[model samples]
Target: MLASRFGAAAVAIMCAASAPAFADDTLKKLGQFQSTGAPGEIPQVEQGGKKAENLRAIAPKIKVPDGFKVELYAIVPDARHMAVGTNVGVVFVGTRKTKAWAVTDRDGDDVADEVKEFAPSIKKSNPNGMCFTPDGFLYMAEHNRVLLFPAAEFFYESPDVAVEVIAEQLIPKAEESFNHGARACVVGPDDKLYIPLGQPFNVPPKDKLPLYDEQGMSGIIRMDRDGKNREVFALGVRNSVGLAFNPKNGELWFTDNQVDGMGDDIPPGELNRATKAGQNFGFPWYGGGMVRTKEYQGEQPPADAVKPEIEFAAHAADLGMRFYTGEQFPEKYRGGIFVAEHGSWNRKKPVGARIMFVTLKADGSADKAEVFADGWLDDKTGRYLGRPVDVAVALDGSLLVSDDLSGAIWRISYKD
Candidate 1:
């Protein structure tokens, strides 16, 4: 029934409106299908007051799979990408402002009873991402630097301690703008910190710098835990908001957001798999294998530069990739890749704003994209409830997707 209505309605809209309108409606219809329940609300948790349980959505309602349930994990007010500690049983998330938080399930009920502010009044240059290492130390990505605090301090009893700068003065400054900031970081299989530095203002570079420059260093960079041995791990990437190392195959995967100013539907965004240390996925010169604008006189990728493993629609704004290693879902979904699309602002029509699952082949490659959660972006009315920014697997093997638009977190788990 839904398909029949969508087919007819889409054809008429496609015929009447421009390609942007047609693409928006079609993608929304594809992303709108989910077994929805009552709305999930954000709970207000103060320092001492009783943590509120029932909070309402500041944006649109979230959607999830069948037999799967969703609840508001934490209403962080401006939450970003999340990091989980396997040993600590604690979830750490950051905000763009001067604060980062640790959400913990103390009583083991699988719900966060306590949400503590770890670093307060932080410098809000660009607090983008955080992650933990196999040895159990916590790391936070400060723009051009990293602040490391003891995980034991957050879990055990400790006063608010100043974060120690394990890495400093690493990222080179951009001349015009630093919008990309330090996007995300993760400890790879080699036990090294893999951090992303984006292009400066999306402008093409005229000449390479003797030291580190923004254009050349815009890709993923790798460093030791002590911030030593800094080198470009990958190149030709404009901005990758989220990245993860696959547990099954030990390969690094990333979601790269393309440049703006091209027509709405020119080049699709990319889900790139980093096969080697120095692989260069096309950016600036070519996006999704489509030639982009000639502005800034960007150079196209060399014929040797690799293409994306999976291509999403233009301006989908894909972020945060996580491999689902949970038992709640069917066997086929055990190790699939889950991505959060933050939705598009420059496009005439909206895309993303939801959590999507892509089935993986035995070779650790993507099959086709599927909607694991929806309703963050409205389908019928063409509005958005919230924009999903990041996704992670919780302690209980459930999925947690962060809504930056509404300052909320939605937890998903499957049941019989």
Candidate 2:
């Protein structure tokens, strides 16, 4: 059933990506499919009923810092990553699954009223990470390809929106893994799309490193907005789910999920800063933060495996993050960062179903990191009420947190 729905785009992607001639033929067919979709016709998600109430009930348990509070914004199932629209403040959410959603508050009330699938006719596979360019083009980085939607916000009301396949075959078919395959992308200050491709295995063999590196399967790769001139931007990443360019200095910052099975506490997760392209963050050799992986213990890591800006608790599963450019919050948070820790799944004692506030110094280095909101995990029973996957800042200065575990988008705002 799943394949029946998303099969066309996926099939086109695989075929078109094999060669340029085939690409033109298959992708054109897909675009023809795109333009024929019914206008002003959108399939909607069931917004009201028990699910929304249950999600709202969990909001009271969400403990925020003083002067801030969180409320249920919208019910967005499998919300993994988010990008606010360039013109109308619509929030486009991507998922690890085939579906992506467009959420709108519609009234500037800080609560989304409509939640609907984006490009419902496209049927792309795992259109997971989404980023909007300054000029209004939206990039959706899928498992094996990257797509561009021009005027995504304006055209989103219709299924017949103009679309382009920016890049093809992000990873070879044999090398792609369902694990760690949710890609995260962003339009950098340089007008390029930076996409992080996670290595599939817990720890890959040494012999495969060169192939992975050549394809940027274990690192971040960037290309021109139109998907031209592609090149690897950084390397040695295990699985980076979050990518943000600091508005202060245009440096890229991302959160990396450390390797698992190294015990719950041995390999810490990372929050890295890429001041320049081609930097490496240790992965197979060092699971995270210098804790070498047993798979490559005897081998030498890259000579310049740059250290992360901040090392998070082991197995915290840090995911989406964004710099705080909103004035709704106090001065301390205005120029800082907010990150969503999806929390650890297999830790002996669970930790990190929370949002973190990291204050940065004048030089763009992190000065401190602390929990800004939590209580998603029941301390008494270890049950998770919600697991946050991404953080997005709104036009009104509110913070939107996407929770796949709870199937909701939460709005966090501050009042003096």
Candidate 3:
């Protein structure tokens, strides 16, 4: 009996070894569908739940400014960066997961009426960067490629809307890491598309520096709408998950996640401003700003490394930010910035998981950073109910915050 069992097990192992290796299912499904077929019904589309009970339970816990009120806008799963559509009451959201989502408010109400999968035909891997041009084109930056959807607002409901590839193999496919794979993109005032390419390592090895520098890794790169005139805009950006162009002067501002494993309060996260191209924000050289990392402690850094304009708390994991240009808020809020701190994962005591407000001076520099909203993380238990990832200003001038942890988009509006 023992001999017979052994023989059977050997046969099973041999059969398993002979089986063909499976290809990625998502890649096979790419470009398979292109038509919506029917209104309000798309296959594999998941709608955002109302979740009234869950909203009521957490609504009171969220603390905003005195005159502002927070309400549940929509329940978007794995929501990350957002792009507000022009002339269409639609909000396009990117995700670190498989799909992108579109949240719409059809009846002129502040609340979102529908949330559905965007371009179900496309197989997206970490499509976490989205931006809209003034001309009504929507561009999405995925892990391995960039795509442009022409007239996205008008043709979003139709699956057959035109799709164009801006670029492929934006980053080296072999160097892809799950830790910092999500890319952030924005359309700059210069009519160029800017995308950040984060280095795969916590502190890149000495041997990899030359290759990284040559490939524009750990830096921001800009190119024309057709992917021409590509050049490195900024360097030494460890992992910037958010990028925004200031409406006043067209300067670029972004949030960088500092290195991990350091003591809690030594190296702070960064809010950096790049006034011109070819600037380098200190990274592995100076983890956040001043504190140096052990990996490159003895090495010399670029002499012209620019410092951060504002420093956030250590391990804050600042992700997405947008300058407040809307008129719905108080006068003080105009020209200010709203940042979503996604919270820290490696900290012994968790920090962040809130919305931060940065007041800017007339010259476009930040004066101070303050907490705009809180209560997502429980101070007593070190537990977070939601992790805010991105902030977008709606057409009505309300602020929309996307929380990937809670799978919800929240709206903060002011009342007189």
Q: Indicate which candidate wins on lDDT.
A: 2
User: How are the candidates ranked when ordered by TM-score, highest leading?
Assistant: 2, 3, 1
| Candidate 2 residue lDDT tens string, 271-347 | 99998988888887889998988888888878988998898999989999999988888888988989999999879
Screening candidate 1 with a backbone cut-off below 3 angstroms (N, C-alpha, C), the clashing residue pairs are 41-55, 42-55, 60-385, 98-122, 285-300
Stretches off by above 4 angstroms in model 2 are 1-34, 37-40
RMSD of each: 17.1, 6.2, 12.5
Q: Tell me the TM-score of each prediction against the true structure.
A: 0.81, 0.91, 0.89
> Candidate 1: where are CA atoms >4 Å away?
1-44, 47-60, 121-124, 152-157, 174-178, 208-216, 296-300
Higher-scoring candidate on TM-score, 1 or 3 = 3
Candidate 3 local distance difference test against the native: 0.83
List ranges where model 3 is wrong by over 4 Å: 1-40, 43-50
**What does candidate 1's lDDT look like per residue over 180-279, in tens digits?**
6646889898878888777665545546432334334558888876677877898878788889888987899998888776778857888888888887
Better of 2 and 3 by TM-score: 2
